[model samples]
Target: MRLRNKPWAKDKLDQYPQYVISGPELLKGKWNGVFDKVQPIHIEIGTGRGRFVTEMAKANPEINYLGIEVQQSVIVTALDRLIEAELPNIKLLNVNAGDVTEFFEKGEVERIYLNFSDPWPKSRHAKRRLTYKTFLKQYEEILINQGEIHFKTDNQGLFEYSLKSFSEYGLLLQYVSLDLHNSNFEGNIMTEYEEKFSKKGHRIFRSEVKYR
Candidate 1:
């Protein structure tokens, strides 16, 4: 679902700096000040439309959740929904995932979520994949030793590639699921994409990757 250019998206986000950090660089290593307390940070990289992250924040009040999305149009919808919820532990970042380190300090994030991310199926575009080794290294820099990545996708090819990428990077795989819906996994949160694909009978793949 490609979004049209919403010229007002940026301004809309600007209206709420507390919920949406417009200039994330200024708050580098100072994210704790935003929430006024030190808490485990969990971010969903590519949080499309904000369904999963918002629900997670509502369900888990103790952990701070950040939803990072490059598209302002997409995030605009999320901001509207989050503001209505008035959640204190959730914030949205209108920044690219590649520059994630510039916003959070090392060992600052406890969990990273990659839900229904772009597969970047082209052979030449492998580097753009979020689970690519390069991106994994970037995540490694911010995630604590015990931190883990929770990833799910409707694309089997991407799932296989991510599994191999994680293994090659010396990360341990836990709770790997080939059919998430039938696996009866506890605490499973469905993204908008996940629900759409699953209803069409697409098998949802999921995995948890952590430092070895």
Candidate 2:
């Protein structure tokens, strides 16, 4: 779950995220200005190296995209991608996923993407997973009703765990795919991990969960 220790992220991560908001203060009952009037926003948590987020932003100019990555090196790469692509619609933030609610006002996010999030494979580490009950609640407060979460990964255990987590939270799961490339879903945006795993002969897993 820690990207700080990675060599690639160590030398290049930007400590101060541009186009960043600090925390939930923006969305609390007493807040004003910031997130209240922005266009529809979509968030990508753990956007490594910015491949997918950059492409998504390039492809979808009407909607704003925010990508957060804890690894400074990765986020630097993300910034580079944005800069090179000349994508004005995308923003990069270097931060952990745990403080999602702290960063935005309530009902500010329209959708969320948990692309290849860390599995946190150990049982005791369940709380660290992004789809944990607590994180889901955070998402609920920030996401509009029927706000959706789009997740994709090559990890089976994590996918199964997330599936259960989504169900327990009463979020409806649709477009579940145990094998992504095998599925008929079109326009699948593949992240760095997705490309790596897909080439390894591993079947990618994907699912869409919507809050009622």
Candidate 3:
């Protein structure tokens, strides 16, 4: 992942001096300047093309939103959209999801949104799935005590596996819906992949998991 030459890399917006931090060295992390008085921050783990989080930021003025993505290409695309929207409550980060806990302070985030995260369907790649316990533990560290994760995906197997993982990790499965589009749920915002999948008639699986 060389970044010295790419156009997106050269103009990247994430200007943090220490963007990469080790998990063991993150207990004293702080970000008061970037976000003045963290007030109910909502984090979206994989913001592809930035439709969902951006729109959510525009719609909700009180809550701060953070969008994280590892790929420079994707984050660059998302940044372009953010610039277009001129969203003030939104921020961007380019980093691996596995290391998110280290970047955020404890209780800094109030909610998490997992929108169509990579399924990693192969049995051997289960740990790579964002809903796996490994990543949930990372989320737990940064999220407030009662903070909840809102997940939506079109993969049945992954959804079921996620429910099991959430339970195994001691998170309470608060809300579960097999079909999100038809559910009369409120405050629903569909991501880029979600809109396409839903239009194709895929049944979206949704759930909210909180600390039990």
What is every candidate's alpha-carbon RMSD to the true fold?
A: 1.1, 3.6, 4.1
Sort every candidate by TM-score, greatest first: 1, 3, 2
Q: How far is candidate 2 from the true structure (C-alpha RMSD, Å)?
A: 3.6
lDDT of 3 by residue, 1-212 (tens): 24343565535554432331123234335544455445678988888768888999989878988787777766677777877777668877666778676678888888999999989999999989998877888888888898899999999999999999998999988899999888989988888788889899999999998975
TM-scores, all candidates, are 0.96, 0.86, 0.87
Cα lDDT tens digits for candidate 2, 1-212:
34444565444443433344345344443222433234788889999889998899878877888888876756777777766687667777677768677777677788999999889999999999999999999999888779999999898999999999999999998779999899899988899889988999999999999999
Show where candidate 2 strays beyond 4 Å. Answer: 1-38
Our model 3 lands, by Cα RMSD against the true structure, at: 4.1
Off by over 4 Å in 1: none
The number of the candidate with the highest lDDT is 1
How well does model 2 score by local distance difference test?
0.80
Worst 10 residues of 1 by lDDT: 28-37
* Candidate 2: 10-residue stretch with minimal lDDT: 28-37
